[model samples]
Target: MSHLFWLDLQNLKRIQHLFPKPRGVARSDDRKVLSGISHVIRNGLRWRDAPAEYGPHKTLYNRFVRWSRLGVFARIFRELAQPGPDGKTIMIDSTHLKAHRTAASLSKGGLKPRAIGRTKGGLNSKLNTVCDGRGRPLTFFLSAGQMSDAKGALALLGSLPPAKILLGDKGYDADWFREALAERGIAACIPAHRGRRDPASHDPCMYRKRHRVENLFARLKDWRRIATRYDRCGELFLSAICIAATVIFWL
Candidate 1:
């Protein structure tokens, strides 16, 4: 078994504040529960494979599912991901995660589709991410892998903090998007798509910074669970991403 990464005392205390104390004897075992959650995300272990030191695998899985629904992980990510001073420049990009065969076995009406779709890479989901200049993930939106980057870019607009410049690839070089950024006093450093006959001019110097978002995606996929989709439900999958992102932010 791969060595699982456990939350340190400082991070555990940070997360413990987000989870309240239970009123009755059904109280949570904080360390064990956190360890179980960390093991799953860090090692990509199936729920049943979780070590007994953490707790009953089923109980841990149930808690994770419940908390995902409550958006606890999302809140924790937001709290810890405070934008740095260098956040004046933000980079946006998208990457795909191949969906495991088991993730496609979702029963009907249980939840909406989990953003998986057929693409050149096979069945995969796309994660559109925004990262700070230092390559720290700020926010991300999920969509089917086949979805257009322009559509994914729409989700990046509202989630980002005020920045002086936004760096992106050719996919984000639409006229309307550039105009929107210009109106907001944010420079668009995206390169034009090849198909455009009259490509708009952009600063070649700043466009080089687009690599940071790509670096963020590479770092995020270091977690095996994030590199391959395992959670059948979209919210649970997103919670997994948020948890991974939170750890990266802390580091």
Candidate 2:
């Protein structure tokens, strides 16, 4: 068997309560199934390529897809990412994920939001995130790759945690966004846009800390599944991201 990653007992215990209880006939072992799922996602391998020790590849794939559709992974991530009492400083930013060609097809009728778009760099999706003072992810939003950073910020605005200050790059430097933050009693440490007639003043010292969110993105992209989009469904892709964040940063 190839080298594989498994959730140790401690980490498994952290999320044990989040797994749904089995009904009727008992299902396969949760640990083995989850480990197989993680292995496939971490290595960006196809379901059929999973090693045997994790159980039949079909079991791993079914468990992941079923749980993702049920929002089990999202709930786990949310529970794990709850803001601490001292989470006063927060950061926001976005990163793009390149979509594989196989990800182009959507289900018939297309009611679901694909979140994939064609940019000069081909098909892509954008992940916008907010992280606490220590760079732990708090919440995130997904959008088409062509969406503007300011727009992405707006989408995540309501979900921003309670914080005294927010750190962001100039991409978030809009009058409305600053006004919104002001209304929420949060200070913005964002630099002014190049074309602004009245440049906004920001503390360069505080702005330096904005790299924490970038660092968070760097760590998240280390998961190959997250670095490249393969799921045709946007929710499933976001679930993959949430699972990775939970295991890597929260667990």
Candidate 3:
């Protein structure tokens, strides 16, 4: 395994227990299988291109697909991503990833909307995330690139730990959303949209910290696979995102 995976032996031990024991011949070389997963996400390499050190590329690819379907990576992310110190405030934001054409073509029986959208950037996907006060990711949601930032807002909010204040840009300033936050006893610190009939009030000082979520996105994109979409299946791509978050952010 390369030095890329920061999770040490102890952390690895903690992570290993999350999955039920793998059955069959594929169960061997679990460590290298995981290492190969990390490698592919870090380098954004195709399964066939994974280095020999990680193990056979076919095994790695099959393992990744199996894990994706089983939500193993997502479980790892949830278990490891500890809540940030300032739990009272949650920052929400979204970023777009340019999807390669390889990710656009689907088999005849494939699913629709795969979270890819046509945009000024061509084919793209939206990655919406919620971060804690210190910019640690709490939850993530993916939608088509052209989807409004607020499209996935409720889903992201639902996954977050209870927080007192929700910070966001003008895009999240909808009346319904504010009301939704209020119902949970959370203060909406989102800036009012320019076209609002009556502008809502928010603390400007607190809003400045919205940059923390932006910074989180910047760090996530540092993973080449995340910077550019490659997987045709949305679930697989999301699994990749979870792997990156667990290894790079949570670790």
Q: Which candidate leads in TM-score?
A: 2
Q: What would the per-residue lDDT of candidate 2 be over residues 166-198, giving only the tens digit for each residue?
A: 999989999999999999999999999888899
- Over 1-251, each residue of candidate 1 has an lDDT whose tens digit, in order, gives 34655667776887778885576677567777867887788778888998877878988888888889988888888888877887799888899999998887765355466788889889889999888888888887888889999999887787777899888988888998898888888888888888889998889988887777777888889888999998878888999999888887763
What Cα-based lDDT does every candidate model obtain? 0.83, 0.91, 0.84
Point out where model 1 deviates above 4 Å: 107-111
In model 3, pairs of residues that clash are none
- Model 3 RMSD vs true structure: 1.9
Tens digits of per-residue lDDT, candidate 3, 1-251, equal 33544336766888888876856654746677787788888888888988887778998899899989899999989888877666998888899998988998763245534888988989899999888898989788999899997778976767767889999998888888889889899999988877778999999999899888888888888889999998989999999999888877777
TM for candidate 2 is: 0.96
Consecutive 10-residue window with the lowest summed lDDT within model 2: 103-112
- Candidate 2's error at 205, in angstroms? 0.7
